[model samples]
Target: MARFTHSNKHTYTGTLLLLSCLALIGAALIADFMLASSSYSPAYLSIASKWAREKSGFIVVPNLNASKVGQKESMAVKDKAERIPERSLSATFADLPAPELEWEQMPSAPVPRLDGAAIQIKNLFYVFAGYGTLDYVHSHVDVYNFSDNKWVDRFDMPKEMAHSHLGVVSDGRYIYVVSGQYGPQCRGPTARTFVLDTKMRKWRSMPPLPAPRYSPATQLWRGRLHVMGGSKENRHTPGLEHWSIAVKDGKALEKEWRTEISIPRGGPHRACIVIKDRLFVIGGQEGDFMAKPGSPIFKCSRRHEVVYADVYMLDEEMKWKTLPPMPKPNSHIECAWVIVNNSIIITGGTTEKHPVTKRMILVGEVFQFHLDSLTWSVIGKLPYRVKTTLTGFWDGWLYFTSGQRDRGPDNPQPRKVIGEMWRTKLHL
Candidate 1:
């Protein structure tokens, strides 16, 4: 209320204006620092919203609880982003490729044939009678020495020996050749059995079976030679009979084959293996080649075949039990077991016919059956589809020789029998 002067009034107004400008500048700098520290903070968002509304002539309200929720959401997003790479890394490691298995070609067999028998005795591999070209049957044995990697010797089989479809097995020193097709081309089977002494290279007659079977499954188990499941004399008829004969020193201790528990499913071309007193028979067919009636030459009759994937196990109690079947139907894989890592591996056999073409499809996948889990998995593949492949496992390598290969679309005949041998390092 003092007397006013013009100069004093101007000076007072100037001082108030300068102080207001300094205060506004300080507030703007503080707001910039808060936004840089946490742009998603509710307070900063509220200020931005307020500025936007003022510029756009709209209403805005600050939500206090949104600040806490925004912080939690931001932390969750950051944590998820950090964990994504760890999961990806773990998946990458799990999907690493299986060890590469490369197959190497070995020396070919002395003679190319089909429906033959093979057995491994230490370093020597013996190839027995088989069907040659044009309905001819071979009655000879070819011996291959793995150490020398060559066909070491060839010897004539006994005159009474069956030429094809013989059930053959070895006991480290002696080879037991059982009943099979006596001659060739849909001919009848023989009940006579014989044993070959590998060391002496001599064949001796054994007791005969009650009846003849074509391509029977034979194995030596617990001092007894077990024979079971083949086509009967009718050829197309499935034989369920199981027989065994006691033997020692390559001679049958019994005068005749003794009857035993019959197999669950039976025909021929099944793979049989004995593991720790358990007998496992896997994959076979219901029908086989038949001889046409009144045909002097016993020409094969056109027939329908029912391939199966049934698996059975003979337990210690002498009882048959069912097991998990193969992933697909497989047959003509008489001796295809490679025991590795408590699992049995079977390769190269005939599977189901092609659905479209209704033609036989040979197997190429290497199948693994885990003994403990009783599960099946496809581990790898063969170089090509094949059947009747004689397989042997030695020194961590799998060897296969003598099989009928797949002749492509041009070949009218389904089988192109080969003598080529192959080996590959087994990696499971």
Candidate 2:
């Protein structure tokens, strides 16, 4: 408003430029205010409609009052609590059970002997008369004391009966030895019967068996020595007849041998055990069978002999009843059988039957038969192939003495003998 002198041209131009910049800034602020107010103002209707249509797909609809993350976390926690029940989880964990079987290996026996006469008198296991080697039979008696876990030398068996295949039974105080073979395969069997007074460590002669037999299944039942199936002439020809002799005054009485029912199929190498006053006879070798007339294999071969897997039960009424047979054929050729936990266990036997060969396959498969269910299951197996092995049960352990091992598959070789003794404890 004050009166001013005339300025330079440059000063005038600078003032004009500053005014122009101010005007542009004012216009920009007015445009921003108008656009911001367009949501409610009627003047910007067209522009607002176009912007809403274009930005509809890209619009972010946000919940201002409630946080999205917090809502999701709350829903997850509620669903988990509703789905999972505490009582159900607790019951599931509580119903779980523990395992059943456990086996423990124990100390070994002193010497290696197969087909030995083994009987338990008190806590001592008497092992007598067995095949020591392929060429020799043993007469020395070894007593294993379970209390001390050591072996003691007992009186050797009589010199005349250095034998194997002896049928042995115990009367707690005395052990009775029945028919046996003097030597190995094909050797003639002896009928000489003897009783060993364990307390006196002496052997005394008794009335012998009516005829010589080997591997007879012998059992002392009701004051009588019962003898059953065994080889009379050879391993192939098994004696089917059954005989029993009464015992009195710790000796075989003057009573002659009485006859009982004979075996249905003759199998000399049979395994017999007494359960619940009944006798169970298990697998053995039942000779051979002829080939069928119209079979392809029969056209080439006339006869093929198979091993036996038969099972029979003898009741107290002198009656014989057939039972379920073994799952596999057993050519015990030589084996050991025992009863544990109400189950009949058979070990160290072969199943193979060659139509033409002198060689026999050996196995260590341990098979167990459950009396209740009458089913067979494999419990465990021996480390090495075993045949003609001696077995004893004491405390809770099963002792396996020396037996024959298989030589490599070279048709036929002398079976290797094992000196190692193994024992396994059965955990209930």
Candidate 3:
């Protein structure tokens, strides 16, 4: 029996040794398989390199050589400023008639006021959320039918006297109203952000801005909405920062406004246009306005009325460059801007101050800056002493309206805001 037990023990030891050797061999095979699988795949290298990674549910890959593309530092200047033909201010007076355009009057809005905003969508004109004397700025949203020269009252602004100077942007389905003033007094600012769902025909709260502010300029970039150049104190600031907001899966996300390389000291009232992914800040008050004896409220040349004659470009590199200057000085130009035929055309805005009130002048003149040429030339203007601010389009016709008309001291028309619509066409 002792002899049998010794033999059995030897057999069991040999079996155990065999099993351990087999297990090691299997493990070594698996290790080699994993190493080969990872090494042979170039796609897995994409996961390893973080530089080209973009994962916001969009899963877009950044161009790996984008940084290597040396910047085109300098551009040959092509555009030049020409003489201001006297025909611009009095085009309809048979002075400077554009060969393609025949100027005439259009029906007016129901109410007479300035500072109102009008937006065009799918061939319909939606004018709303502006402020003027009817006690305080208006809350009533008016819709004008250019086809029939009729008016319809839609939804009133959620709040009152929110003389909102901000523009609206939409994806053809949802219209987003950005930041502006809420209280009758500009002292009280509003950070409210509202979105109107055209499909639902209802208002929904997306997100409120970080602070109550007005004149928040917004544009869409790389599928994200970017807003820049606004006020914290209702005047010029070294603090006019740039911010970006994004919408994903129908939910909105915002980043804090970051000071982006200090944009030139352009006023919030400046005319800004985004052409070819570049932000052009043109035609605005240059100096910051603070309420005081020599502030912008005072209209002093160095203090309040520093007109922006040069065009500043914020290119894709996010750098600022001074472009060609306008022929004449321009400021407080009411809606002195209009975008037509892929070119930014600017018309009547006050180039001079009022002799008596010392306020910004109400000049009826026009200019066109061809984006490709980066040059300027005087265009067409209205015949009468036209005032402006709210400028937009309707019924295939360019319409201008809602500006402050200059009234003499005895005019008592201090609040005599005018709301007239002048319709014209953009000659190619």
Which model scores highest in lDDT?
1
Ten-residue stretch with the least lDDT total in model 2:
87-96
- Candidate 1 residue-wise lDDT, 2-99, digit = tens: 55588798767777678889989888666645534342344334333422332223233333333343334335465565533211211111011122
lDDT scores in order? 0.76, 0.63, 0.54
TM-score of each: 0.74, 0.66, 0.64
Off by over 4 Å in 1: 1-100, 409-413
Q: Give me candidate 2's TM-score against the actual structure.
A: 0.66
If both were scored by TM-score, which would come out higher, candidate 1 or candidate 3?
A: 1
Which ten-residue region of model 1 has the weakest summed lDDT? 88-97
For model 2, what is the alpha-carbon lDDT of residue 354? 31
Give Cα distance to truth, residue 358, candidate 2, Å: 7.3
Per-residue alpha-carbon lDDT of candidate 3 for residues 332-421, written as tens digits (9 for 90 to 100)? 442456677777776555553432344444545566777877776656655333444566655456766666654432221223577676
Candidate 2 Cα deviation (angstroms), residue 124: 1.8
What is candidate 2's lDDT per residue for 56-122, written digit by digit as tens? 2212222222222222333546556543232111111101122223334445556677666677776
Stretches of model 2 off by over 4 angstroms after superposition: 1-110, 287-306, 333-335, 354-358, 408-414
Q: Candidate 1 has which clashing residue pairs, if any?
A: none
Q: Which pairs clash in the backbone of model 2?
A: none
